[model samples]
Target chain A: MGPITENHLPRGLKLLLILAACRGPEPQIPIDPTRSLTLQTDWKFTSPFSGLFYDYYRNENLIFSGDLRTNLILRVFNHAGDSQYDIPLKAVLDTLEDINSCALFAPDSLFVMEVHSPRYAIVDKQGRVCRVSSLAHALCPEPGNRYEVSGYSNGIASNGRSLFMSAAWWGDCDNTGWDPSISRFQYIQRYHLEGARKCRIAKIKLDPDGSKVHFGGCNILPHLTDVPRFSYSGMERVLLNGKLFLFSPVAPYILQLDTGTLNVVHRIPIDFLNGPAAFFPPPITEENLQNGGDLVSKPSIAGLAYDTSSGYYVVAVLHEVPIDTPEGENHLDRPWSLIVLDQTFTKVAEHIIPGKLYRPNHLLSTTAGVYVHRNIPGRAGVVGPKTFHRIILP
Target chain B: MMRKVIIWSVFAVSCVPGSQDARLSRYLQEQIGLTERQFPKAIVVVSEDGCPHCDRAFADLVRPRTSLRDCLFLIRIDGTTVDLHGFMVETQNVRFDDDRSFKKLAS
Candidate 1:
């Protein structure tokens, strides 16, 4: 072949270059570091959990909590504090065998929860199961007898018209071993507010033969060039100018897709507010180890919430540090941090949550108060109930 | 003769597998007890849905590869499954209680 001309370049490569060049530098926005409030509850729960907080009537009077374990959403409150209601999700959970993940589709007045039995159910304000859809049934007919509906929906968002959610296909990941080369087939999907299947969406599959692909285990590098292979995780959707902005926590990247054309128009890099590996504790030196310190780090983004008030997305990251002890076990404490990014998906602000906070799975903004559910370890037991903080966002 | 030699060289290069991918596969098998032969038939079973660790596990299993063809029959499984025979091959090291059972037979 003679010298390749511009025509030789693939359409994707050309478009990528054009978008990269045309897109102006991301605008910087200031973040109010003190713009946060926390409401602690006397309750606590065991690990391996999911939760949601919502208000039914938009009365801004009653707030509710749904715990995955009790399989019941109950009305809860403190006599001295503001009035809060816990609406039992049993009506919805009863329709499904088990719940995997849940979200409050605020715009639609519906609570969408995913079941490991391979179904999504939409519950109404009265806690009645309004609609139900099987994820496996919609995705594949012969989805195969070997296929197990992996319970790992990382992110859930809505466009007022429909609910968009993403899940990492884990069945293939677990049995196939932990090779980075073979990872990437994890699937993501979108659903209607009524729990109807919309689309399975696309997945980036890594080469199994492992020629061009290289796996880095669990950690993700900010630079794409650093790894030959990686996958998307924890996706969040925001409607910007009639288009959909998709954000993934794993890659810390955002994609602007035109709804009309269904084409990706732009890819933006998101900068976490905390420094690289900021979630993890420092390595144990001889001095530190002697003093009862060990190497500990929790450097993953567990939650993503779009804050419409500030025109930015707030990310909940779990930061952990190992306690200095003889066993050198990791004392993973959740220091909730918010990384704010503007419409362009640029990092604007970063704030670390103070006090003893556990992993936060959901962040909700309501007229009543900002509700957040903390992911507590299962050992905490079913009694005492898990903590759900209703903070009045500043 | 030169033309023939050049053609043969090109064919040989095409047949040779990339070392990088092989190294990666080896690394994965060693670290996670996952291997190429097993990946094609293996199914991933996650502890919880929407859990980040499960996400990481899936991401690592499906990352892109250069030398390997997509021959693996990968599947996603939930942790609640009482029986995993269809997806997981019974291994000697894996043990289950009366609540579950796994018999290791020659694959």
Candidate 2:
């Protein structure tokens, strides 16, 4: 063939090459919630930063993540997902109390919501514990537990000034808490921080009556002593427009309740909310669920989160995929898939995490990409090292 | 009881297909880079020169099968070493202490 040159190339080929250059940096891949993310472990920190949803971003798309108690350190990341700096907390907050769960209150500080008590602490960037005060009795009131069983408040998220916490595992009528065989009702409480001085707890009546509708707490039964077909069940959430939307790493669904009315406004069913399906008692209520109805075939929803830039929800589902073997037959398989959906709860895109690459806890979408961190907890206040995977999506 | 359990395990292993779907076998072959046609008898964690925990995990999941040289998965326990072979569990009557890994019946 004569010398192969650009001039000899077809008009379409020339145009394609020109357009590719105009597109900077290989047209950044839109994060495929279904695909495995790139694992970045360069940020060096000793303590376990257990806080989920590292979504608070400042200038240069720099996102902030830290815990007033967990790791007692702050980490900043550039839009490129590179760690900028580590801010130590021992210098900031003087209250020796370890935080139960915490979050990035703003660009300048760490918001520590007390683990068992009613105090809220704010540790600023300059290593200063700015505010420490008791929440109104209404917000911090003793949870009667109904069954008077153990009380645990988790899934903490904030909209700058206010804080939201949902009850993770509630006991059944007899206190057989978190038993997969039996279902239990659930609720989340909201508190307006003293930052504005209201510091009062907003009493959410929880639909007040038991008969009409009560959100069910997901399951995590450990006594089975055997492998559970599906063990994806936990409540974690985000607040939008004063409403509390709780999701699970277990259940394949998102629940929206009116904080004002405490009425379950919507139970969005993620039909493809991949997870192990069998052996779970219909979730206290069988209103809306995308479970496959059995254990033989199911999807694994490892984590869920909301992306501000896209106004869409990113759900990490470890789906049981079927692959043909050398025997010429297909067997069901489980792998990670990061799914993105619009605010309207419509499926937007599906990205495969490619093989059993990640075990997701919280999925955070950002200018840099997405962060999947599993809360690998160690014994009493000690947590495992920072093991998180970050990947750019397309 | 032990004899019955072992006998039942052998029969079950021979009779029933593994508990996992084929996608898992593909993951072992593709993601973790395992070889095809290799009958995985046990999963061994090839420790990185001197990683103790990796050694333990390898030992923990290493339930000797009838045929040792037939196949073995050397996973790295120091990092995110997914026991893809762990998912290739057999539906045999053998009690799966944790359902993490199971031995293949002599074929």
Candidate 3:
């Protein structure tokens, strides 16, 4: 065989090298020790659990909260943050079938959230799947989980024109031989949504300097540092002013990334809360795991949104009762707590909500208030079917 | 030459997703039907094992929630090339051309 030369290089291989070089370096978001962005919200919810999925419509003209079931409800909220029935989702998702996953909706989106064979679809106002195009994936390795870590799209959000997606990563290092102390990760590929801005996928490094953070299982690493993930919440992108901000569903900090470059420009760590796993919560039982591998439980900021009307950052905190639960059982079904932070990301108010969050973006912060989904446990009578709770914080 | 073919056949026939977490395989098999019987888009998400964020994300994806099966997203977390591609019997021969975007699942 003739000696291989530059001319013999496959065209695609050459293009790949060019893309890799231009892909740039992995993101390095500095941990600002000076930012004490934590707060103490003594406020507590007094209402019964009512609804879960919350999304604001038309600049807070309408607020909708539903059980994410057959009932897509719209509620009207007064300036006092109280709510009553307004209408239902413009697109009926409850009666809709064929479309899997949550009904991804945003005011600025061109197509309602739909995934199909080629893997892109759009739903109409009538809750019908349209323009179902199954584009073939190039079989590229998912950017975030390089070592074959299992994960999923966390939630869906849009920036007026383009859609932004965030995913969760979980796997074990027991036999992988990777460091069990400090976390190693594959660089997330930045994606360009057909209509959205250039999205640079950054690597997630959650070495939180001895703070207690939760992974899937009870097996806690003594320490973890550098926590940054760029997945946006489904209800609303972690958008403030004009920038795309992101938070690890299980981490204690928020990241602000450059819109064009998708690089971390600034990071505000939620230092007030304890992190790096003050202690590991027990692993989910095989029964509770259902099918996923066992997971460690710990404190986390599941969802965050900047409420325009109230001018507060509504954060959903999922953890075992910070204080002792009345039953004293370390139930994995920790009620999602709602924390309100100011422009500077300081905790201003907090309330213990009554619901179990199944997804990181299950907690939706709207202009009126926040909505959270409560997953039903095995004991139907105890937790009941999944529902959303509309909270009015004082 | 015939021996090589025989060995390859055995390998192909035995190429089951036995290496995958039985729980995850079942969960994906259950949830992934986006259209009339069409499977949702399957993507490989990469993260180091034993990380907290990755752990939480992995659990959230695998856990079955609503009876209302919406858009089923297919996620293959980690495993050997065989484990990643070896889903159904027909997929035993499904090979990704390379690590490039929009890889057509050549069945």
lDDT of each: 0.40, 0.43, 0.36
Model 2, A21: alpha-carbon shift in Å? 32
What's the distance in Å from true for residue B83, model 3?
30
Candidate 1 residue-wise lDDT, A1-394, digit = tens: 6998769999999999899999987533222223432333322321122223223344332223335432355333331124344456767656776665454545234434455454566666567776665544333322321222232443333333344444333433224354454422221111111111112222211122321111111122234222222233334444433455554434345566655443567765544544442222223233443332222343455555554345555556555544432121233344556666667666766766642443444555443233455444332322334344543222
Q: Give the number of the best model, judged by lDDT.
A: 2
Q: State the lDDT of candidate 2 residue by residue for A1-394, as single tens digits.
A: 7899999989999999999888865323233444433223322222123333333443334444454423456676554446666667775346735445555546666655554555656667676777666442333233432211101223355555444554322223244334454333222111101011111122222111211112223222322213322232234556543456665443446667666554557776665543331234232223323342343333545556655555667766656543322111111124456677788877777776543233454455554445665333212111233444554432
lDDT of 3 by residue, A1-394 (tens): 9998868899999888888889967532211222211111111111111112223443542222222222332333432234533334335333232222332334211122222221334544344544444322211233422121111333333343333443222222233244455432322111101101212232221121311111111111111221222222111235554556665433345666665555567666653334431122223232433322222244655566565556666666666454444221334366545667787767777655444433324544544445444443322312132244444444
- TM-score winner, 2 or 3: 2
Please compute DockQ, using alpha carbons, for every candidate against the native two-chain complex: 0.02, 0.04, 0.02
Output per-candidate TM-scores for chain A, rounded to 2 decimals: 0.49, 0.52, 0.46
Candidate 3, A131: how far from true, in Å?
Answer: 1.3
Which structure is stronger by DockQ: 2 or 3?
2
| CA displacement after TM-score superposition, residue A115 of candidate 1 (Å) | 3.5
Off by over 4 Å in 3: A1-58, A61-118, A134-154, A167-243, A276-294, A320-332, A335-337, A349-361, A372-394, B1-107
| B1-107 per-residue lDDT for model 3 (tens digits) | 43443344345333435544343344345433223344322333322233434433443433332122332222222221111222211121122222221111211
Model 2 chain A poorest ten-residue lDDT run: A188-197
lDDT of 3 at A255: 66
- Cα deviation of A4 in candidate 1 (Å)? 90
